[model samples]
Target chain A: MLRIAASGDWTIAHLSAADGELRSLTAGPVKAGRAVIDFSGIARFDTSSAAVLERTARLLEEKGLRVEFEGVSEPQRRLLDKIDTYGTPDTSKAPPAPFYIELVERIGVTTREIGEEARGMLGFIGTVVSAIGRTAANPRRFRLVPFVHHMEKSGFDALPLVCLLTFLIGAVVAQQGAVQLRQFGAEVFTVNLIAIIFLREVGLLLTAIIVAGRSGSAFTAEIGSMKMREEIDAMRALGLDPMEMLVIPRVAALTVTLPLLTFIADLMGLLGGGVVVFFMLDMSPGVYMSRVQEAVDFWTIAVGLIKAPFMAAVIALVGCRAGLSVTGSAESVGAMTTRSVVRSIFLVIILDALFAMFFTAVGI
Target chain B: MAQKGEPIIEVEGLMTRFGDHVIHEDLDLTVNRGEVIGIVGGSGTGKSVLLRTILGLKKPDAGRIRVFGIDLAELPEEERRLHERRWGVLFQDGALFSALTIAENIQVPYREHLHLSQELMDELAAIKIAMVGLRPTAASLYPSELSGGMRKRAGLARALALDPEILFLDEPTAGLDPIGAAAFDDLINELKEALGLTVFLVTHDLDTLHATCDRIAVLAEKHVILVGTIDDMLRSDHPWIHEYFHGPRARAALAGK
Candidate 1:
């Protein structure tokens, strides 16, 4: 038998220094059929290093040597026995897949996920539409208090923020348009440019984006947390239709509020354009208002207003769908909230582009 | 073995209050090394508050707490951290980081405190997962994927990651079934014997106390009213103490023991 003296502090704090020596002992040429590890001089031991020692013995035994511990203290022996009886550690993690294979796998997964998401969203929209229709037919089924509360929260509270953002955007458009048009001595047309853009596109799209971020995110978070806490299930257990109780009020409020907010945004945007034209192009408010009045007909404003409720419906539907899909984790609530905002904004922009194309084709 | 009277934790005249509401006042308790001490109390008695106070998680209103013969409040920040590594705490919920896997959770303390290599840490994490009665496959799972009992076991494995000298458990067996709770009690007993760990357990599980505790400390009237073995508890004349030990649940626990 070959003897190995395993001594000193066999604890976590000292294990790093002893690691190489212990490994060399295990890997060195074995002159004898058996090896005895003497532990009489060990001043301290702990579970951390007991794991290391147990591993070292296993390695030695696997190398065709009979490994035995000798002269361990009572406590050390008990620890060793405990570690020995515990199952072995799994040291090998499977290797990752190759890059091209993983890339193909990811593309397939993403495509499937997008398809499922589209199907789920369409189903949710149908459910919300039916609920709205039911409440419309039977007016008493419409919850008055919650509808009023939601209008106040998702509509009235959003007024100042929406007005301020659209005003800034309108000012920027006036300033940039004046600078560009001045190159051709057409700076006087800045008012006409601002009027058409704000009424036809900017007012409606900007308000939709803001509300999607603000109220839409709130809707997803509220319902997602409710789902997480099992409150949604409780509502069903109490024979309440969550669609009517929660979804209809919030969606109807958004649909009503988005148009009103868009109208206010249109006014604030024109006021901002008037102010910028007065300072930058030396045009008075009267001249600016007259130019804006002659820029387009009722079609300019009607085009933007016509898209408001559709955008509202899409945003509300996306938010509620994300909320209802939340699983039993706090992390899922955050992830779904983000998804709601992003998807709503993306869908709103796509709908705006499609509306613009249709109106141009029909000579609006 | 540690000497009979070697105290690892000593709390004297510890007072804790939340604004005007006093949770504990003039409380005192001593926990000897290498023994399991169970703290029991009524609903509002603040058994967990005492544990938190000793662990320095909550500031005491007025008192001194000494752990390992040194007052933690008097130690400088760096030295306090060194002492802090000697003890570990398991909260009522697993409280595992939701983002990390079970193996990564167990390696958190090791990565923070030790200079071990990745392979060594992985091996250690696997051992801890198995030691806590978790299957090897659970190493890759997130805490949210685990059942309540499994989460508690994973929490225990994380607590033992650094080979702490003292383990503090707050209601370790609270949500587990009876069989799971009894197995947990046996695991604690076996771990204490093998590693010579000093345990500070705060729980209402009478069966756990009967199976694992070296002594029981009863908290009442904002102080430790009694501290002794179960027999000493059965002989006490204090009204709350009498009711607690002679209760039907206590009789069943004692009979089972």
Candidate 2:
């Protein structure tokens, strides 16, 4: 028989020390035989230390020894028994895969998720298209209140920021253009450069990017939180189509507002360019205005206007789809809102590039 | 642990206010070691606020709160933390950190307070998980994945990680089904007896009060109107206390007990 004496404060405060000592005692080179763990010298006892003692006994017992407890008081025995009942917990969760295998698995999962996302987005677009068609077929079915509310929210509320940003970009462009043209003794050409860039590209591009960041994120947060709360589920349960009630109003309002905002951006950009030319080039506002008129025709101005409604529709669709796809959590809502802004901005830039190529091929 | 029947928590002339809304006024109570004390009240009587104040999460406007015979508010920061470590608290909804697994949550207090090997901590976490009646698989699962009842159990396990001498539970049975609630009551009773823990329970469930509480404290008119055993509560002639103990639901709870 092997005798082991357990002593000292066997509580949580001294748990690690006690555990280490007990483990070392069990690890010594003793033949497997009847072992007695005596606790008579123990000054204090608690469940944590009891667990260590029980674990040590079990380890010894598994190695072909009969383990017995001696000198345990009644309360201490009850605690020891309580820890014994729980036993050693099984922590046999699957180990992580090797790095290369995990990489390959992650790549496969990401590819599949992207494919599903594309299919879902296409399906959502189709639903929105049909809902718009239905509303157009019956004008009375259109929700006037929400449409107007969204128009004010996405359009009117976005006006100041869009104008301010486009105006600053226009002024910076004209100032830089004038400096470069002056080196070539053609400072007068700055007005033409400003007119062409603002009317053909910058106005609608800047406005679209701004609205995508502002209104797009708002739409996602509003709808995503509602989705998290099961309000979307409740609406579907009540037989109300979310496409008609939620998506159509927001999309249609953005489509109508983007072109109008682009027009305002174009005017603001010209006014800003005129101010810079007048101040820096010693050109009068009258001369700048006439030069702008001489540089731009209906085609240059229509190039940006034509791309407005398409980008607006894309942004609104991306935002609404992300919102509807939100799972039931605050974290998911935040992630979806961020995805809405990022995706809408990306698609707007891609759409602008496509429109630029189309207009170039058609000799616009 | 202090000797049984020794005062572990003492509150005198306590007042809690939010702006012009007074929650508690001149409230007094003493909690002895090794007792399950339940705090009960009608809606909007500040039961949770009182618990928060006692936990020092909120400062009482006017009062003295002495825990383990030390006035917590007057103690230095380092010493106050030492006193605070003697107790554990379970919030209304098991506020487990969403990012951590249940095992990691249980290990949090241990990691903060003690120096132990990773392997030992993992063993202790598994033991805690089993002690709270959770399946072994629950150790690896996140808080969001667990059901309402399982989350509460996980929260209780985390609270008990340090082997705290006192356990403060807020509405422990509020969202549980009747069967689940009864099981929880039994678990609390068992843990308290085995650990020699003083339990401060804030609950609305009459069945829980009947099954687990050693004493009941009733809150009314922004103060504790009475504190006693169930028999004393039943004998009280105060309108709210009389109606509370004689209500139809109370009758059913009493019959079940």
Candidate 3:
């Protein structure tokens, strides 16, 4: 019979044949019945290994041999009891052990899944492009409800801030223009310069930037929340065209509202410039108004209004597009909303410059 | 009983691949009218993907899906929209609009698909809310104000707003207490009976399966291993089935019986 030797560390190492002399002295003989399994140094037992010990015990019992546990540990005894309660230890189909390799394989699989999901974004972009084309073709389907809501929320509601911003900008421009004109004893020319510049470029640009920051971000957050909650999915399931139901209304609303807001911003800016001329340049309201009338033509105001719809379209498109890009995660919604604001502002500025150049070339 | 007519939803050889990995392969399922079917699987088992594919949110690389006899792959965008108006879905977490009141949420389907007066829409919305067992006072509250179970009930109210014949629910009782979950199950059973709706329920809750499912399809080993009643599942010879049903929770539930 083979027996384990105690190593004094609560763990027994295998007994070698050279240790037979000590084994013989301890047990008086090396017969199977005289062999005592010392579990005194054994610790940290598991179910599978405990099963092997139980099997050995059963074999010894069947042979009419008494196996004694001289110093069996309490933990080892508890492990054995657990094994008994839990039934068989079928270690026949145990999995392979290289844990890091399995982890890497799982990470690779997840990475591939995410990569595929990102690639699917291109399909969504394509859908957006097709939606835009369809909207252009059948403008009638783009209903007035979203447009009305957006106008009230994004345009009409934004009037106070737009007016205040334009007024401040007009005052600053007039003051600066007055400083230079004063040097030449032509301070009244500041009125014409401020009015012309505002109607031509500053009014529309300022209004667009405000909308890009305000309404554009609002659209992103709203849509992003919907995407996260799967309301977008519910809409699709109900056979509702999400673009028609969600996007078109926003686009129409911004488009209708921007032009109206721009008109208001332009008027406020002119009034602000007139006030500066009246106070700083000491020009009368009549003289300043007459000069503005002479320098700032209908064409300048028309050019500014023309840019309004374009700016509105850009803001709405960027906002809605970023909103649609949300992927039903809280982080994704936040990230996409930020992207919407950045994209809207960037597009608005770039388009403003382009319109400036175009109108400049056309001698507007 | 399923009639001899076409199934409401038919998915054949549904294979969806994301980049180099395949989510599912050679999958086939048939959902008939007026049948309540439950789909059960571990997390990340493509159950949600399967539902999304049926709704045309995802286009499977190699498969055909037909909803209400209209082949999704073959239908044009207009036709797809027309088919979409016939079904309803209650997403996981209920997915109610946070900005809208419960009544307003229910009014969404009616406002989009039908040309009804504001008074009529309000009346219908109220009726739908009442049908879901929500109080009239709760109708004016926003989704953020509602509890998890209430949100789900409100979402069900919205889904029923269109009088849809088919309803898909994804994890309807996911975050509720057991008592609340059982109550939701009772609501589902009542609604199904009253509306004659064909329900496609996706969940991992064993209690939900034992209580409400007429038949359950278990996804395991990258395939559907079993589709049967609770008794059949308990008696199954499969190792996974034995392990699942003999677990502590199942044992406790059985012991109480």
Q: What DockQ does each listed candidate score?
A: 0.71, 0.56, 0.01
Give the distance in Å from residue B7's predicted Cα in candidate 2 to where it truly belongs.
Answer: 1.4
lDDT of 2 by residue, A1-364 (tens): 8888988778787788777877787777667789999999898787788888899998888778999999998778888888889988676568889999999999999999989999999999888888989989998989989999999999999999998998999999999999999999999999999999999899998999999999999899988999999999999999998888899999999999999999999999988888899899989988888888899899999998999999999989998989999986788989999999999999999999999899989999
Among the numbered candidates, top DockQ falls to: 1
Interface RMSD of 2: 1.6
Who is ahead in TM-score, 1 or 2? 1
Candidate 2 residues lying further than 4 Å off, grouped into runs, are A1-6, A21-30, A41-44, A180-183, A237-239
Best by lDDT: 2
The local lDDT score (0 to 100) that residue B240 gets in candidate 3 is 79
DockQ result, candidate 3? 0.01
If the candidates were sorted by their DockQ against the true structure, best first, what order would they fall in? 1, 2, 3
Q: Lowest-scoring 10 consecutive residues by lDDT in candidate 2 chain B?
A: B1-10
* Tens-digit lDDT track of model 1 for A1-364: 8777877778887787677677787778766488888888788899878888888888888888898888888888898888888758886888999999999999999999999998988888888888889988999999988888988998899999998999999999999999999999988888889999999999999999999999999999999999999999999999999999999888888989999999999999998888898899888888877788899789999999999999998898889889999999999999999999999999999999999899999999
Q: Give the candidates in order of lDDT, highest first.
A: 2, 1, 3
| Model 3 / residue B232 / CA error / Å | 2.4
- Residue-level lDDT for A23 in candidate 1: 71
lDDT of 3 by residue, A1-364 (tens): 5464443322111212213334244434334564466766654332223444554454554555676655666656664554344333221323686989999999999899768755765565476568768977988877677668777999888999999999999988998999999999888788778878898789999999999899999999998899889999999999888888788788878988999999999989988888888898788888877888889778978998999998898898888878887874576778888888887888788998898899889887
